[model samples]
Target: MKLPINESGLAASQLIYGCMGLGGGWNRDPIQSEHITQAHEVVELALENGINMFDHADIYAFGKAETVFGQVLKEKPTLRENMILQSKLGIRFPDEEKGLPARYDFSKSYILDSVDGILSRLNIDYLDVLLLHRPDVLMDSREVAEAFHQLKSSGKVRYFGVSNMSAGQIRLLQNNCNEKLIVNQLEMSLDKIGWLETGVHVNQVAARDNVLPEGTLEYCQLENIQLQAWGSLAKGIYTGRDLENAGENVKNTALLVQRFAEEKQVSQEAIVLAWLMKHPAAIQPVIGTTNLARIQGCVEALKVTLSRDEWYTLYVSSRGVSLP
Candidate 1:
């Protein structure tokens, strides 16, 4: 339940409850007023299960995610010190009146202003972590570094991280920013690891190639930055579908795995989570499930150690082929 720490020395739960799903549950539908109480109650459930970290983005549900998270904090303000609350900035929501300014904003002025906005929304004086939601190709390292310095010195944000950034992009800012960015929350999952390879996912075949380099994975390991895995359930891609091994075989395999999950006293989601945790790298999987039962199952992944061969088997299943 304790956090998986990184080089910059920040730590929080290995299983961070993604707040996007909180604004709207798995159905991507808003929680009704009747459900709001229990919805907020889920925060306590997550915390009791050792999930002290919560991940949210500024644009999630057009900012309702942070608002709801703020409500949870207000209801349990005393729990603030016990948890590591985090959110991201950057993605400007579209507004016709605002000249349709839908784009990534990493400018110094934007970054500073975003902090104040998030502070007011979350009702927290300071954040445990603040991430640049995604890389801005036009990002100026000097501008970002200056904003980071100001935020850290003013105690507006205690820790810094980046999301959806490549190894090189992170280095660009990391080198410039005097305050160390503690982590990089990449959109990584075993299935989404096309970033780890150099195919169409990385483009020997596309015009604008995937920015992730072949050495990206190796670089993170060498640098000691904890990779937070998003979309860990393959975005529920295999829910009722076949395992990569056999199309017709999924019904039974899925049922069997689901049964094992129950017998092992974990949800099916946890099985996927455990698969990620099996990796040696200090990676954390962000779980977006709103069901407390499923949330608890994900937390269980930290202890479920898959054997080396089993790990590859799952990898092969995910790839729909054996490794070369």
Candidate 2:
């Protein structure tokens, strides 16, 4: 269940526990002590199940999620050495500034200032990794490289990566940075199958109409960049659906997932996630559920390996049409 982070020779759990759900809500609500307890329970469950990497972002619950996680670290400082902590920055919510809209900011100053805020909120001096949450169209690769250099030199961050970025964008940033970009996080799941569809439909008329950015998956595999999947379960469409309320395709997919789960003696969630892990790129599914049972169920995916036919069945069922 361990995957290499890069050539750094360091490895982390194949399943990452996303901290977005740790905080009670996604607004500007004040973090409560109960939130700390909830985070502690979830963190303990993840660690107990061999998940050592925790993912976070500055905007998760408007920063309350990081605060709750930080409180857990404060109460149990020894746990820090047992985990890899990663957080993201560069997403800015709309503020009081006149005529300003919610946007991304990868400017050197914003990146630097955001890291400090993340550290202060998390009560940590350093992060195992820091990801630029999203692409800022106005970003200057040179400025990003400078920020990365300063963060690394100051011992504030150990590794750098990007989320929701294309291969070209990653190359643009990598060319200017001294450090290698180790990972790319994207929304990939059974239902959200564009990442797979584009490749499957290559050179065909259907491929021309595919919305996925071509070559991103292959590029990550070629460059040895880890692929982290954000919405790996597609919000429980494959595993948690009520067939009576679902459409024909969803109901059929759920039934197929159930059949596989029964045959393999695993949870439906494991079937859904294992299908993703079967890819050659070694995708790491980030599970954000706060439910302990669901977390344990997802961990079962580490043990369930789908056969090629089973994989294709699920893929075709999800696509609602045979591969072109």
Per-model clash counts, in order, read 1, 0
- Candidate 2 lands at a TM-score of 0.97
On TM-score, the leading prediction is: 2
Off by over 4 Å in 1: 7-9, 24-32, 98-101, 198-211, 239-265
TM-score of 1: 0.86
- Top model by lDDT, which number? 2
What are the runs in model 2 whose C-alpha is more than 4 Å off? 243-246
Q: Against the hidden true structure, what lDDT does model 1 obtain?
A: 0.73
User: What global local distance difference test value does model 2 have?
Assistant: 0.91
User: How do the residues 1-324 of candidate 1 rate in per-residue lDDT, one tens digit apiece?
Assistant: 565566545557778888886555434465465445655777889888888888878777766677777877787789888878889998886579868867888999999998898888788999888999977879999889999999999999988888877778888888998877677777766566565444334334542455566656666677776778888766664444445764533344355446546767766677677777776776788888776666776777776766686666555665554445
Q: What lDDT score is found at residue 37 in candidate 2?
A: 91
lDDT tens per residue, model 2, 92-157: 998775777899999999999999999998889999989999999999999999999999999999
